[model samples]
Target chain A: MSNFDVIAMALKNLFKRKLRTFLTILGVIIGTASIVVMISLGLALNKNFDSQISQISDITLIHVVGVDQISSQSQGSKNKIKMDDSAVYNFKQIENVESVSPIINLSYAIKAISGKYSATLNLVGIDAQFLETLGYELESGRFLNDDDKLNIVCGGQVPYSFAKNTKRRFYFYDPNQQEKAPDIDVMKDRITISVDMDYGNIDTTGEKSTTSTAKAHPVKFVGVLKYDDFSYSPSDYNCYMTIEQVKKLKAEKQKFDKSSANNNSGFYSDNNSDGYNEIDIKCKDINSVKDIAEKVKDMGYNAYYAGEYLESMRSTAANMQALLGAIGAVSLFVAAIGIANTMVMSVYERTREIGIMKVIGASIYDIKKLFLVESSTIGFLGGIIGALFSLLISYLLNTTNISFFNNDSYIYMSSAAQKPLVSLVPLWLCIAAVVFSGLVGLLSGYFPARRATKLSALTAIKSE
Target chain B: MKNIIELSAIKKIYKMGSEKIVALNNINLNFEQNKIYCILGTSGSGKSTLLNLIAGLEKPSAGQILFKNMHIENFNEEQLAEFRKKYIGFVFQSYNLFPTMTALENVSLPLVFSRVPKKIRIKRAREMLKNVGLENRINHKPSQMSGGQQQRVSIARAFVNNPQVIFADEPTGNLDTKTTFEMMDLITGIARKNNQTLIIVTHDLEISDYADTIIHIRDGVVDEIKNKE
Candidate 1:
């Protein structure tokens, strides 16, 4: 008989016992839904970990620090790998390296001031041309260009960087606007930058006394970055300037008066030439972080990235998925048994019909295909319904009222762009669930279909 | 007329716990094309067993049943099924139709196994049902039909495929006397019109009166052969 005829007959047979077929399909639905939902929870956990890691550090960035900074670990290693212009150039030559910029962090020796307001400064000096590639987002103004001389990009916290205004605080998502707004507008105002630590001392300035003076230069305002609770970009809470401008500021400080500038800036430890103290390397993608970091470590510089944490977190999620999936498979196993039992009962009930078909020239292959098609159709229906049901359940569980996965790491994704997830059913998981249930049906129906094919036409005809 | 089926020295034995009961022994027969043959025997006289053997439903222990120069007894189950599909049709004593299928579906079943397209097979089955005077009961299932009407549906099914050979094992076994005569006439008439071989196994002498040849069997062996034409 033709396959089309066999399928038509199989569907008719399934339709003959609607209640039994429905019950069998219900078992498979529960099985598939349980598996899909379980894996979705594990996927949510993976997403949560990724969100948390992204808050503290970019997974693709490798921070290269000079050996002098790692004095605790490498006491005598003469490895001359400095975090300088040469090291930055060599890192850019590495495969998969997207961009490299040398950086220097100065927290104490730098100060910025408006007419009557003094601001405490954490200044970061880097290549001005690489500002855009470094993932800095602007709140008001533009990034520093290559032609900028004394321009500086202020941090997102520039409003609260007052020197002694200890009572004032800044909240990123402040709702009650009753708190006194800062009088300083960094983006529109010009600021004077001084390399002297004692530039703003009132007592020494009141008497014009013996503190060696360095003139503060007027720096132009460029960009002010927007705050991102989930990002660790370099310009988040610091001012960015070109490395050449900061170096020139230091030179001017020394030329004006050698005493205060030569005092204790900690910009150097006397064991090295003039080079940058830090280099930030941006990789093309997350997968290249570990390899590039390892190569930098071989060059005797300290390389740090969050790729190791990402690996452990991902493996943990995968293990959870396996455990949960196996637990759900037990129910599916029971459903398979239900399918087998239903098919076996159908075989016995239709023994006489099978005999009629055989004597009427229907082949044994046709008989087998008929039963198999019936069971698989049940599975296909159950699988599709079950996968969709899993999505609904996941959404309900992840809702704010349930808050099933409300945890520390998930707080950032609750923003408008994305929601915090407790359960996540991806597309491929649904496809896998459907295909797996069909295979289960095919397997369960195998023996019963075999028994149907082995039925003797004469005896079966005589049976009833 | 030419012999379409030849059976020689056929033997069928049943084993019941080390006891061998011989159902048929030394049976030799030839069925000619375009002729009706009747094998008459009392109950338990191996008439039905002979019909089953010649129909390729049962294999004999020692025999050569030849059809178109091929040994039917030596053919495997699959080959026998293929051979049956190509050349054989059956009208059972109980009118074994699928209880769920309608009269038209029952008649078209043979054509379905022959892989005839749906449109052509339905058309052929409808025509065959019309010939058996079941044109109005085409949609009625076997359970909804009377014994005579069900038997007519079975006859239509047998002739729908137009096979080379038709076997009827007590075709009217459950019918009244008038219905039995009518079923026999309808089946024999279709077989003769198609120039096909018809073999009927029954004990009723009245039913054998419609046959072209009659063979009487006693015990496992043939007692006499008589040609009425």
Candidate 2:
């Protein structure tokens, strides 16, 4: 018999027992939806972690560092150790270590028109070679240059300088007097800044027991800090100047301390004994960062890259994906069982009908295929529904009030240009959902179909 | 006359609790083409067993059954399916029409199994419905029709495929006296018009009046074979 006849007949039979068919299909629906939703959650987590990864560093960029081992039996003896200069030289020799530099951290003041902002300064004293390693783009000014005197670079969105504008507006007057005019921007243009500085040693415990014998430098105002509100980033109030200028101030301070120490030249202990305290090493690609860091650690220093943070973020996303996938898969399994039960019941109810078909020349294979087609159709419908529902749920949660961390206070709202918590479902996942549900239907219906086909025609005919 | 169905020394033994009961004994019978033959017997008299053997629904323990010289007893399930599709049509006492299908759809079932074109099958089914005086009831399901009317639809289905043989198992058993005669006339007329062999298994001897030949079966044995002029 033609396959259509089998399918048509099976469909008719299914329609006859509408509630039973639906209950059976519901099982498959639950199973399919669970699988789809689980996988979808996996995708969502994958996207979230991937975005967080970019926050640490551009995945394409790598970092390199220098180090030295303190002992022969140190933990990382497998790799060679080298000094900062030697490390820089070796990195330069490597074909893929694009650039390298030695850096030092020193404290400095960020001067503004109204006040001075003195925070713990991360004074990254880098040469022109190590500029790319910082991963910061300059918004309006140039980066550090070898020949350009007194020039410095900073992150593109850093708030180092502030600007103000003034405008005029009309003010209301008393009933007995003429209309008055005032410049509203004048009051707002006068910026005020309160500077909190931590000098030599202040006892935070005792109220008035702080002492400072050393002289404090009073900074002058050159510019105000600009506004930068990058999401999740702790703001840095910074000032930019040449590395030479900062070193000169340190040298003068060391000399003044020595002169005041009863003319003892060695008393200051040669403050700049270690010429380079920090370094930002840049490389050709991200894949090399972990290896380079290991090499640097062997040299007796802590080494890391922007890309390491990205790796952590990616791992976080992968874990979340697995969690969601598990949840979805459970439902799909339950649905398959439902489909199996429905087909079995159908076989029992249609025993006589099956016999009639057999007598009218329907083959055993024909009967089997008929039930299989009905089951496949149920799975197909469930898949389509589950896919659409998953997509809708993802969009709703991402756009509305749903938090994975259960922290309503820490909701990350999407601003005008930024995308909302990404609900990304791949095309392959949709296809998988459909095919998987269909296969579940097929498997669940197989045994029942066989049993129905094996029904002896004589007995089936005699059955009421 | 050519023998459309020939059964030689057929035996069907059944085990009932402790005793072995013979549903059909070693009996030989030949059913000719273009003739209506009836096997008349009471309940449990082996008439249905004889029909089943001829339809290839059951196999005899001894001897063989041949349809147009092809031994059906030797054919496998798949082969029997093919045989039924091309050459056999069956009508049951309870009017075994698929309740889900309309009368016309039930009649076209045999044609569908044979992979007949949709247009041609529907047309042939409609013509068969007309032949059985069920033209207006073509779209009604078996549940919507009376017992006699349902049997008529079943007869149309049996004749729709133009099979070599039509087997009716108590076709008029569920019908009233007036409806039984009407149904018998319709079935016999269609079988005669198609020049096909008709085998009717019935307990009602009155309904055998329409048949050209009658075979009396008693206690699994053939008692007599009578031919009317």
Candidate 3:
């Protein structure tokens, strides 16, 4: 028979028992929707984890805290590789290494003083040229130039860190974003950084030591930084200075503290020429982070980045997805049995009709094809509607606060992040669901259709 | 006239557990082209088995059946379907119309199997229905028609493909005398009009009156062969 004839007859037969057909199709619809939504949930979890990780740490940036001297291949070979100038040179030679910048803080001894207002913060000293690669967003003015001697770029929340007399701590409270305008007009005021912790302290005892207070240099407030939320931003409460500027301040402070023999306040007489304790290295991409970080570890350094954590998180999400997909597969399997049952019953009811057609000249192939087409049509319809239905379910899931699991477990570092979307559907998954359901229909109908083709024409026609 | 179908030394045996019941034995028959023929016998006389054997519904134990010199018994299931699609038609005792299909759709079934295009098949089915006096019942389903009308639709279905032979098995068994006479007249008139071979299996002597040749069988064997032409 012609294709049109077969298809038309199939559709007619299905409509003959509309309620049964609808129930079978409903089973398939539920099956397909469950599968798609379950997979989408797993995918969205991974996406959420990625965004959370990106907030706390740059996946492409690796921080080398210390050299692993004991674990090094050449343990006692030559000079030790530390997180210093020599290590920076060695790190640059590694392929895919974009840039390297050392991070140094003058031991919280530096205080920013603007008349009566002063703030004690971690006064970091970085190479002025490396500021561009450091991903700092300035709210006003410009970045420190290469020739800048004392130009300082204050952090986004530096103003809130300032207290009136440097005695009482200023604990600012902004739950989501702990950043706001400075209490003092830092941009316009004449500020100086002093190594003496008592630079702006109210001397309650009125006791004058033999040595005068350490010299405080005048500082230009070059710029203020934008308050991008601290959940992902790095060092939003610290201020920056050129490396030379911090060295000059700290060396002078060491000389004064050493001369005062009575003041053995744990100040180091050595110039720390060994190297800075921490170095930040940026890579070209997240994919290269693990490889270069591994090479640095082999060279005896504790190189760390988010890629390792991300890989583990991705695998966990994949495992969870497979589990969820298996759950959904059970639904489809049940629906397949429903289709098979319906088709078998249809074959039984149509035995006499099949015989009549055989006598009228229908081939066995035609008989089998007719039944398969009917069942597959049910499956295809169910799958298509199910895909669409899952989208609706996904929208409801994301919009409504349906927390399948707390993101606190999935987030890499930050605990204060907003909840991640719970469901995500890719285009291919929807298409696969439909095609797979149709294939399931064909497979389920196979036996019933075979039985139909095997019905004896003489006996079948003789039946009432 | 040339013979269209030939059956020689045909035998049909039905197995009842360990017992073998010989339904038809040592039967020989020939049907001519474009002639009305009948196989007449009483109930359980093996006439139906003989008809079934000739129709290729059941294989013979030791015989050869040929149609137009092509051995019908040798053809496999697929080739038999091909043969039937091109040459054979069937009308049943109960009409056997597809309950859901309209009268026109039922009539066009054979043509649909023959791979005739829809428009042309519908046209041929309409013409055949018109010949059977069912032109007004084109869209009526079998449940909506009387037994006579349903039989008329069945006759149209059998003849729609313009097949060379039509088989009517107890076509009047379910009809009243008036309706049965009308159905026979309509069926035979169309068969003769197309110059096609007709094979009717029935026990009624009156129903066999229209046939050009009648074969009488009793107790699994042909007892008489009469030619009225």
Ranking by TM-score: 3, 2, 1
lDDT of 1 by residue, B102-210 (tens): 9999999888788899999999999999999999999999999999999999989888988899989888889999999899889999998999989999999999999
Q: How many clashes would you count in candidate 3?
A: 2
Question: TM-score for every candidate vs. truth?
Answer: 0.80, 0.82, 0.89
Residues A400-426, model 2: lDDT tens digits: 755563223223422234443646667
- DockQ for every prediction shown: 0.48, 0.74, 0.73
> Candidate 3 - CAPRI tier?
medium
Tens digits of per-residue lDDT for model 3, B61-132: 878898899988888878877888889899999889999999999999988888899999899989989988
List, residue by residue over A42-105, the lDDT tens digit for candidate 3. 9898887777677656778898877675775467656656667888898889999999878666
Candidate 3, position B114, lDDT: 80
TM-score of chain A of 1: 0.75
The candidate that achieves the highest DockQ relative to the unseen native structure: 2
Candidate 3, position A82, lDDT: 64
For residues B80-172, write the lDDT of model 2, one tens digit per residue. 888888899898898899888899999998888888889999999999999889999999999999888899898888888898899999888
